[model samples]
Target: MTNKLTVKIWRGKEQGDFVSYEVPRLASQTVLDVVTYVQRNLEPSLGYRFACRVGMCGSCAMTVNGVARWTCRTHVSKVVGEGQLEIAPLANLPVVKDLVTDMSEFFDKWARAKGSFKGKRTRADDFEPVKPDSRERKAADAGVECIGCGVCYASCDVVSSRPDYLGPAALNRAWTLVNDVRDTQQRERLRAVAGDAGCHACHTQGSCTVHCPKQISPTAGIAGLKRVVGRAAVRGRL
Candidate 1:
């Protein structure tokens, strides 16, 4: 095995090109480690975002060899091609600098999708009991673990074609909220995800599911949203 790896990293903002660097290859080294090495040793000016390097924060997501992944958990050995690596900011989002894309649009779409829960009970009320075995609870539990990572968003091809598309993460969050029995905004949330740029716009490419580091199936969530919205529309309640 070679002791060194060639890395081509995107430099500057959205307008810049890839810059090549030679980095040391080590045992069990991750892609984030390589980028960190380059920034700390070779080029201190290199800009990137990372927190909770163990992979929980999902802030270190990037495009590795044309695929979106969580660099914190992506092993260099698994992704190295011909002893080389290419790292860039997540796609489909505005680039802030090098490797850090603006996340405002992503969160904004989440809000537009009505991803937050609006409980019917007041703060003075007692805690609501949710049956663990109930279908609604199960469905909600299935997708409640999303960490707002952009991996699914970046991997979505529909976002590339339709810039206004609400994207997968937002739809997935909406689905989770729709299943929450305690939520009082189901009608509005369903309507929010039913528009042209909403769940109806998804092409079901499953790219979001394929690349999600959290293994959350935004495609499945979008499908569920489609069914709910369709039923509501058929009932003339949408």
Candidate 2:
């Protein structure tokens, strides 16, 4: 793969155009590798975000060829066609620079979803015994490895349409705590995730689930929240 790969990347904000760059192709290189090459060798002005470079951080996500992917893990061979690649910022977010996007809206939704754990116990108190095999712990464990990247948020169609929507990642985080027997904010959390702008807004399209680099199904977890909230509301507990 020594041929020069033609890379088309979106420059600036929504008002910018796609600029082309002929990046030298290498065997077994990832999409991030190409971006790094261009930044280090071809264009130092190019902007993008990356940290672990090993797919764990999820900071290197970009629209590779048209799909949201962790560039650190996406292989060039998997996405390239005729030595050409179209790279762009993650969808559903304001592009700050080339491949970088502002994540404020995405994180704000976490607050809106009441995703934080509100515990009643202090550090001085004895450790809370949680059964690993218990239903609550099992459900919480199902989607606890989220890295807080905006990939799922960017991949969601409902989020693109509704800025007020809580989106999948935040709702999934709420679900993890929703089933936690130790969390004291259960009722309030349920209320936060109820109604049109919360869990009910999810179309269940599964784009968030499909694009999640951590393999966490936020859609499934959000659905669980919806059911829990619906049941509680019916019981007059919400």
Candidate 3:
């Protein structure tokens, strides 16, 4: 293989185009490495975001070859097609510049879903014991490992067409809180996530689950929310 790779990186704001650059191809080359090389060598003005070059921090997520992924974990050899690569900001969000998308809307939807835990306990209250083996705890634990990465949000088509739709991450977060036994806002949260702009909007195509670097099933979480909402409506609690 030649020691050079042609990478088309998106530049500028919402109204930008992909600017191609030739980067060195090395062993164990990652997409992040290519971007870094371009930023350090080819272009000094390029913009992107990355932290914790390992897979733990999802700040490196971007559209690689039309698929949302963590650039830190994506190897050049695996995703490069025809000796070329296309890197852009995550989809379904406003691009601030180049590969950096404005995540304010994504987090706003999380707040709209009432993803925060609202409990009756105060700092002086005794620690609430939650058995890991219990069904409720298990359900809450299923979706709690989210890193707030925008990959799932960008992969969701519902968010693309309907900007008001709470994306997968927000709904998954709400599902976790809904299952929290110690939370006092279950009824209100269920109502918040029940309408067309919430869990009801998910088409269940499983794209979020497929592209999640953490192997999380936001689809499962959304489905659980649906069931919980249905039960609440039946019980006149919604």
- The lDDT per prediction is 0.93, 0.91, 0.93
For candidate 3, write residues 1-238 as lDDT tens digits: 4588999999999998999999878999999999999999989899999999999989999999999999999999999999899999999999999999999999999999998998998999998988889898898888899999999999998888999999999999999998888999987899999988989899999999999999999999999998989888899988
Please, what is the TM-score per model? 0.98, 0.97, 0.98
**Model 1, span 99-141: residue lDDT tens:** 9899999999999999888997898999999999999898888
Alpha-carbon shift of residue 54 in model 2 (angstroms): 0.7
Residue 2 in candidate 1, Cα distance off native in Å: 7.1
Candidate 2 C-alpha lDDT tens digits along 1-238: 5688899988888789898999888999999998999899888999999999987898999999889999999999999988799999999999899899999888888998888888889999998989999999999999999988888998899988998898998999999998889999888889999968999999999999998989999989988987898899899998
True lDDT of residue 12, candidate 2: 86
What is the TM-score of candidate 2? 0.97
Clash pairs for candidate 1? none
Q: Which segments of candidate 1 are over 4 A away from where they belong?
A: none
